[model samples]
Target: MSWTKVVAITGCDSGLGWAIAARAAREGLVTIAGMYNGSDTEAARALKNLCAHPYKLDVTDSKSVTEFQNYVKNVLQENPKYKLYAVVNNAGVMTVGNYEWQTPQMIENMINVNLLGAMRVVSSFLPELRKNGAINDFKPRIINVASHCGLQALPCFGPYSASKAGLLAWTRALHLEHFRDGLSVISFIPGGFIGSSNLTMNQVENGNKMLSHLTEEQKSIYEKRIRTLNKYLGQASNNTRYDSLSNEVIIETFVKALIDNKPKQVYKVEPWRYKFYYNLLKMPFPDIMYYWIIKKFLAFPDSE
Candidate 1:
C-alpha cells in the first residue's frame, strides 16, 4: 500500500462531516465522503469542487455498507498505492424529549444510526486496514463524533444522550483493544451547541410532529424544555457574526489526530466549563442534587 493520506467519512452531506471532508480535501488528502444525500445538488456540487468522491452510503443499511466496503476495497486493490488512513463515523441524528415519549422505532433508529452505524464502518474497514498494514503504510485511525450529551443525561434529551454515551463507551473499548495495532482512535465530544448543516430545520419540524401525541401537561413540560434549549440552538444558528463556534473545530481536530505522533484518545471541544456538566453527572452526591434541582423546575412527568 502506498502512503498517501486518504480518509473515509460517513454523513459527509452536511454538518461536521461535510466540514471535515472539505478540509481534508483542501489539505490534499484523498477524501472519500459517504453520504446518504449524495444525489442532492449541494452535495454533488461540493463533491465535484472538492474532488471528494461521493458514495451513496446509508449507514443504517447493511447492503449499502457492504457496497461501500467493496467499492473502497476495489479502488485500493486496483491502485495498491493508496490506502485509507482514517474513518470518521460522523453520521448522526438527534432526537428530543423524554424516553417515555419516544416510540420504539424512534429509539431504535437513533441507536442503529448513531451507535451501530459507527461499529459497522469500523468492522467493514478493518480488512482494508489489515491489508495496508501488511504493506507497511497503514496507520489506521477511527474518529467517532460524539457529543457533550454522551457525557451526561440532560433533562429531556433521552435518545440522543443515550446513543452518544454508548458511542463513548464503544470508542473507549476499541481504543483499549487496539492500543498496539497502530490504530489511533479518537472519540470527539463537542461541548455546548454547534450550528447545524445536514440536519436541517425539517428534522426539528418532524420531531415536533412526533411529540404532538403527548397530553397537554406533557406538552407543556416539553415546550418548557424546548424553549430553554431553543434559545441556545437558535442563537448558534442565526447569530453567526457574534462569536459563533464553527464546526471547523471538528475538522482541525481530525487533522491533528491524523498527523500527530501520539494523539489523545478523547478531545472535548469548547473547553472546561462546558465539559463540567458532563463530568458532574458522574459525581455522587452534589451531581444527583444538581440535576434533580433542574429537573424539578422542568416539571418532569414523575413529578406530575
Candidate 2:
C-alpha cells in the first residue's frame, strides 16, 4: 500500500497558517489545521471546503494540544495510508509597546503562545513524527514560523522579539539534537504581513490596557508616544498593498520549504528594504547609529 503524506499546521484561523493549509491540501497532502477559534469559525469552514481537517486547538493549553494530538492519531488510524510528515508551528500573537508598558500577563501571554505553545505541539507529536520518518524512509520536518523581530529587536516589540528569539534558539537546538534521528527543523520568517494577519488585531485595545496600568508619572511620560505608536500600528495594519505582496512571497517561500529536497536552515521572505536593513544591522556599526537608523525607519517618537 502506498503511503500518503500529511502535514499538521497550527493557527489556521487566518493568515499564513490558513494559506499553508490551503496550499497543502491543493497539493494533495492531507492537511490538518489547528484553529484557535474552533472548527465552527468561517475560517475553519473554508478550510473544510478546501478538503483540509480543521480542529479546535489552543497551543497554550496542554489539554487542548493533547486533544488535538489524539484527533490526529485517530485520523492516522482511520486512514492507514496517511503518514504524518510535517508539523508547522505557525500560531502566534503580537502586541506592541515599550518594555515598561508591557504588563507581566502581557509578557507571559506572548511567550506562552509564541514560544512555549510551539514546544507543546512539537513535544506531543515528535515521537510519532520520528517513527513515521524512520519507517517511511523520509525526513520529518518541524517548520517554525518565526519573525525578523527575533533577529533584530525593534522599539515597541520587546516581548514579541524576545519570544521569537527564544523560538529560533529552540529550533536550532532541536534540529541539532535530532539530526541523527532524521528529523529536520527550520525557521521560517514571514516578515511584516500585519495587514494580512490578525496578529495586531488587538493593538488599540492592548494600548488602552497598558495605559490603564500605568502610574500618573508613567502615563505622563508615555501617553503621547503610546498614542502615536497606536496610530502608526493602525495605519500599518491597513496597508493592503504591501500586505498582499508579502503574503505572496511568504506563501511561495513556504511551498519551497515544504517540498525542497534539501531545505535551508532558515527561510526568510521579506521586501528588499527589510533585506537591506538586515544587512546594515549585520555590519560593524555603533549602537547610536543602529538606534538612530531604527528610529527613523520605524518612526518612533523621540524621547521627551
Candidate 3:
C-alpha cells in the first residue's frame, strides 16, 4: 500500500464543486472530478481542462457508485503509488416549500439525494481510503457539503432544511464514529445560493410543480405565504453579489477541508449575520425580539 495524495470531489460539473476541483488541481493534488451529467454541460468542459481526471458518477445509484469506485481503484492500482486522500460528498438537491405542501416525491428526492446519496458514495469508497490512503497523508477527511439550512431552518424551506439537518447530524456522527479509524468528517455549511451557478431554479420549478397538486382550499390557506416566499427567493437569487462571496473563500475552504493539518468541524461560508443568527437562536428570547426579526427578513409567513 503506497501513499500518494489524491482527492475525489463529487458534483464537479457545476457550482462550488467545479471551483473546488479546479482549485485542487491547480494546487497539485491529483484530483478526481465526479460528474453526473455526462458530456453535456459547459461546466463539464471547463472541468476537463483542469489538472484533474473527470469520471461519471451518479451518487443516487448504487451501481454507479460501485462502478466509479472500481474505476478509481483500477487507476490507483495501475499507478501503484497514488491513494485517495479525501472523499468530498458535494452533490445535493434542494427543495424549498411549506412542509405540508411538499409532495412525497419532493420530500423523498431531497432526502435521498442530499442525505442517502452521499452515504452511498462515502460507504462505497471507505475501503480504498483505509488502504494506506489519507491516513498516511496525515489528515484523512470525509466532507459533506451541507448548508446553513441545517443549523437554522426558515419557514418555507422545510424540506431542504430537513435534509440538511439530517446531513449535519450524519456528519457529526461520522466524525465521532470513525475517529479511531482515522477518518474526519467535516460539515461545510454554504449559504443559500440561487442562480445559474447553484441549484435554485431546479428547486423552485420542482417545488411549484409539487404544489400544483394541492386542492384549491389547501392552496388558499398557504397561497399568500407561498407567493411571499417566491418573492423572497427571487430576491435571494439576485443577491449573488453578496459581499462575502468569492472564488478565494470557497476554494480555500475546500483546500483546508482536504489538506489542512487541522480542519474546522464546521466550515461555514456565510457572513457575519449568519453567525449572529446562530448565536441569537441559542438565546432564550421572546417572540418580539430576535425570532421576530428573523421571520421578517429571512423567512416567509407560513400557515399554521
- Candidate that scores best on TM-score: 2
> In terms of lDDT, which candidate is stronger, 1 or 3?
3
RMSD of every prediction: 4.4, 2.3, 3.4
lDDT of 1 by residue, 74-94 (tens): 766776567777888989877
Q: Write one digit per residue (lDDT tens) for candidate 2, span 1-304.
A: 4778889999888777888888889889899999998999777887799899999999999999999999999999998888898999999999999889988888899999999999999999999877766764566789999999999988778999999999999999999888778778989998877777777777888888889989999998889988878776766656332113336778889988887777888998879888878788888989999987787666655654
Deviating ranges (above 4 Å) for candidate 2: 238-246, 300-304
The 10-residue segment of model 3 with minimum total lDDT is 237-246
Colliding residue pairs in candidate 1: none
Best by lDDT: 2
Tell me the lDDT of model 3 at 144: 95
TM-scores, one per candidate: 0.81, 0.94, 0.87
Q: What value does the lDDT take at residue 168 in candidate 1?
A: 95
What is the clash count for each candidate, in the order shown?
0, 0, 0
Q: Candidate 3 — which residues are off by over 4 angstroms?
A: 133-137, 231-245, 287-291, 299-304
